[model samples]
Target chain A: MRGRARDGDEQRFLDITGEIGPELLRYFQRRIGSDAPDLVAEVMVTVWRKRALLPLEHEHARMWCFGIARNLLRNYSRGEQRRSELSRALRATVSVTDVELDSEEAVAIRDLIYQLGPDLAEVVTLTHWEGFSLAEIARLQGVPAATVRGRYRRARLALLAALSTDVAPTLL
Target chain B: MTQDKDHPAGTDRELGALLARGARPTTEATTEVRDQLAEMAAAIVSTNQARSRRRAGLISVIVAPILVLGVAGTAYAVTNIDWSQLWHNTPEWAEWAQDPDATVHYALPGGGTCELRLGEVVYSPDPNRPADVAADPRAEQAARDFLRTADLLTVADVDAMITAMRDKDENWAQADDGTAVPFGYGTDNYNADVEYNMAVKQAIQVAVTDHVESMGIPSTGLGFQSQEQCTGADQ
Candidate 1:
């Protein structure tokens, strides 16, 4: 009986990891860049440990994993900034640019998105980049679907306004 | 470099396309990374299962003697033995023996084991007097000492202890809704885990309220409490 149970868990785990593992890598990469793989590995182990809590529906499961990835990214960002500051003081000047992880185009657009503030940028990123609908983003972000919709609308208008200015030529 | 398929027409389409191109992952998780992730997860799950089994075995080793001693103590209780002489000869302070309620035995995070018996009035041993002569009432001090050593305990440690306890229960499958139980079982285990977690947490709260209130030391109320008299080579 235990043998069959173990087999079932192994299969469930495989199904979950196969579905979300790559997407989580992409999710973290968009936010954290070079540290993404290690964080993806951390998220995988967390997903495995918390497999029972995973939503049965595929889309909802993706949202659940995204929620975990977002939380981890927040913690990493907070701690990483402090650590990097301390390290910078002690170490010699080094570039530390991760060419493989951060593309020039992505970084440029990311800077532009950040101009919209965190809530707006989050709605835009989740909607456009991660391919979550407003309703799904609401569930992940713990807000109403209408709220997410409003943020996305505001973001679009803001980005368009920016684009119509001096930056329009470069973006186009 | 990215396909523009998601957004509707006009400026929305252009903005969405740009965002998609910009925020897209620079590197996808390759086949090798995925395989390595699976292997790492498998190893973690397997190690936890093995540890659970070891803990289950350890519980039996701990519980079997307690069960035998319970029976022996019951017989001794009824026999009307010499109270003073027996108390003197016992050599060790066994509060759980005297007052059995609210005792929890758990492993320390670093190493060794602790048995905590709460709300029991402890008496300083007197060879000339009867066992029930007087209650020294040092349970607060014992609880305080317990808190000192248990500073390292965390919620994860508590959950791990609960998992260990659950693993030892042969009737756990039948105890919950009858389904083929996995190592990490579904909703039933989750509910049980939450309930057990709450009970242990409440036990700590009760211990704090009972003992720490008088010390006037505001209880930060972290981790489990233990009896210093209960631990060590004397046990």
Candidate 2:
């Protein structure tokens, strides 16, 4: 019975890995560009380590994986200087055209999302990009729903201001 | 683009849609990266399984003996067993010998004694004592390097080396300085003897140096001396 349960857990882990593996790869690619492959390996290893504790529901498990990825990114960054260094490094290596942004407007929006700072940027990413609700993000982040809501609100305001300024020059 | 207090929802919905579209995944996972992730997952599962088996075995060993004993005997056994010793009683080689009173005095090559306690060189009667007798800053670092090398050797490799060294037919020669060196054993097959001898010697050197340094002793000129040799020298 114990062996069977363990086998079931392994299967569940593999199932989730297959489902989200490509999404996770792209997630890291968007953030770290060429370093994504290595980061994906790291994130998968962590997911395997926490397999026993992962939620049975697929949706919750996906969020749990993202939570681990977020922690890994924070650890990798270590400081604001390192974070900026990573951004600069990625920018140097990857062209805007290579990023597959649909249009110039899309590139501008993506750039503005990054300007919201790491904390607000993550909140916006989880909400819009990942399609996690504020409550789901709160649970993943171990914070209150209200905190995520406030962060998302602030991030949206920043994005709106940046967008308006970007268009104002053309209008003038 | 116009901001309205009552219709803040419109602005949020528009921005959210834009972000969602922009951040959508545009690339696929390469076959190589996927395969590497699969390999890592398998390795993690294997490791966890081994850990779980070890934990189960340990728990059974502890629990089975208590069950065999009567209730009163079990209680007595639990109370009598020194739980502290389980963690504190590490092998002398592995332990950081920090007890101040448990000092080991070594005879210098020239004359007089070098007193080592914990990691400190408390006293050295030798006139040629280094300026820093308290500790060799490099000793711990050297020991760490040795440990990293030692980690590569498996238990079977270490056991094979020991067995070969102990064999009478194995050419265990004594150098002019009286250090025992093993040779010719397991040499024809695998060069196991040479590898083992080097590894063991390095381990012993690191252990002795690390122990002395723990007591704040200058590990310069200090060599690996067994407790028996030091005791016999004292006599």
Candidate 3:
């Protein structure tokens, strides 16, 4: 009987792995680049260890994984170089499209987004890049949805203002 | 575009498109890595399960005897058992027991000491030994029996068993003087406990011996060697 329960837990954990494993990998990749795979494995092991605490709702479960990934990322960020160096490192390994990395417009826009400060930049990246809604980002960030929305507004206006002066002709 | 709660309007569709380009499309592990991850998960689950089983077994072994004794109106002794002496090596026992890990030792009903690490034997006195090999296989088996029937047995469990034995002993002494009529127990109850006490002690002796000597094949049933018998030697 205990064996059956354990088998069930193992299967459920694997199912969770299949569902969010990819997104978790990308979440790490976006932040830490090559270390993402190792971190993903670590997160899966941790999820299994703390499987009892996993939320039952599907969205919450997914967010639960992202939450773990986010915390791990924070720990990883400590004692590391700046995010730009990580971006450059990730960029080297990945093949990019003409607009993604090759184009001058893309580079200028990326730079402007980086200059938006970590809080604003994160809200924009989470919204645009990861495709999370403001509410979901709010949950992941453990802040109010309105706070995320405000940050998003601030980030967009800053990027728009910067684009208008320097890169507007090329980008617009 | 219509403004909605989820997506704010006029957030520059062009800018959104540009930012979206940087998003890495769904990272996937190779077939090899996925297989490895599954294997890792299995190992972790199996390891945890084994630990759980060992702990559960330990608890049952320790609790069952106490529960049985609780029924015999001998429950008062439950709180009196020195549980630490059963599970942990005391400084006094550490000097002669040889292994600091050994929490307690029992003298096999016949001969030899059964050194135990919490109801499990770590060392056993060997009757078959050439005086060179310190551990006796039968002694270990005796310990196993002692553990099994004795109920990972708390001192209370031993006390109950001893009480039964001593009650009979007192009756026998009185019977010798032709005075006392073994009160509260008929001949059967005393006989059962006496036989049980020996069977448990012998079984533990056999199990510990078989276990330590053979290292394979476990003996069935629980047995306990006489604690009083060994306590005398240790003190």
Candidate 4:
């Protein structure tokens, strides 16, 4: 939002986690709604541990990640539900947006963003599609504050051009 | 699409920032998750290393007696140790092989070699005599023990045994009853090879128990395979 912030050295996380994190977040969110944060934490821990399993290609990695998440979903369901308050306490630890994006739009945005090369695509998609704060993306991507901005600028312009419509300044 | 994350009032900027956030688990979470997975991987490696070390240790233990005896510098001193009594007291292969008739040899791949011939072959000759015996694990094992037994023999004796092993005859002769047999398995120059092969068999015999166990044989089943699937390749 602050005009394309640069997140430097996200190569490792970018190369691994990519956009899979949020998709996993959403997956855990829906399968076990309000308990989403704990599930998200659990899913991420899984991603990190099995990070080697992720494909080097970010797109393919995301798909493979979700496939794992789907399995985790089964695991979560079969599990005896933890105390509601305990999960509530865990969810409260993080300030995540409750706003749900339309899956169809999320997919469209993801596809548009994916069109960019890895770096620009990652920043653009994570910021716009996955809904991470620049601070968070900067942290995860391991980039200094400025690089994220440059990537975002190039990403926004490219995204705008790809969408081909200035009518809704943001979707691009 | 409906809410328009990109807004003229700088909505797309805010939208982009939100999209990039992924869940970063805490350190405890990271450790907890990776611990189990890494532990599983480590366990597999450790198990293999342990088995290898165990076999190595067994071999060292088996060879200890031989080295002790060799260093004692007197064959008679070795013969004097009521080996049967020692074997009964120790209740281990080392004592059992101390018998004058029992042959002991060190082999590679671990499980120090011990060939306890019950004075004679327990099972009848494979009918075809030694050739029909087909050099199974047992035969290979016996070959090793024979090496040690042959150790008690003079150079001339080893030469004779090596000829028999090769199925040829340098000093080939008929028994008093004129039983002219082809003997080429034992020769003096072949001692090194015999030593090496015996070491290999010792290792194979010890390390291959796992493979042999799964082969549906009790693994202790008498008689060696022509080519043991475990440590041996097609000979």
Q: By TM-score, who's the top model here? A: 1
Residue pairs of candidate 1 with colliding backbone atoms: none
User: What 10-residue stretch in candidate 3 chain B is worst by lDDT?
Assistant: B63-72
Q: Could you estimate the TM-score for every candidate?
A: 0.51, 0.44, 0.45, 0.24
What does the lDDT come to for candidate 2?
0.47
Q: Which digits, one per residue and each the tens of the lDDT, describe model 1 over residues B21-111?
A: 6764445455655565565455546644654564455433221111110111211222222222211234454654455334555543324
Tens digits of per-residue lDDT for model 3 on A1-172?
Answer: 0123546667777777766765676776665555565556556645765565566677888888787776656546433322221123223333231122235555556677778887788788877766788888889888998898889888888776776684442553
| Per-residue lDDT of model 2, residues A24-91, tens digit only | 76777666555554445445555664455678778888888887677656545322121121123223
What are the chain A TM-scores for all the models, listed individually?
0.76, 0.71, 0.74, 0.40
Off by over 4 Å in 1: A1-7, A78-98, A101-105, A165-169, B1-11, B57-235
Query: What lDDT tens digits, residue by residue, belong to model 4 across residues B1-235?
Result: 2233322124675444423332222222333333432332233234334545644554333211111111122111221222222112233433334343433233323333333222222222233332212213343334233233332211112222322334433323233444433222453222233233333333333323322221222222232321111222111
| Better structure of 2 and 4 per DockQ | 2
Of the true contacts between chains A and B, what fraction does model 2 have?
0.20
The candidates, ranked best first by lDDT, are 1, 3, 2, 4
CAPRI-style quality class for the chain A–B interface of candidate 2:
incorrect
Q: What is the descending TM-score order?
A: 1, 3, 2, 4
Over B54-151, each residue of candidate 3 has an lDDT whose tens digit, in order, gives 43555333212210211122211222322223222344443323432224454544343444433323432223423322332344444444344322
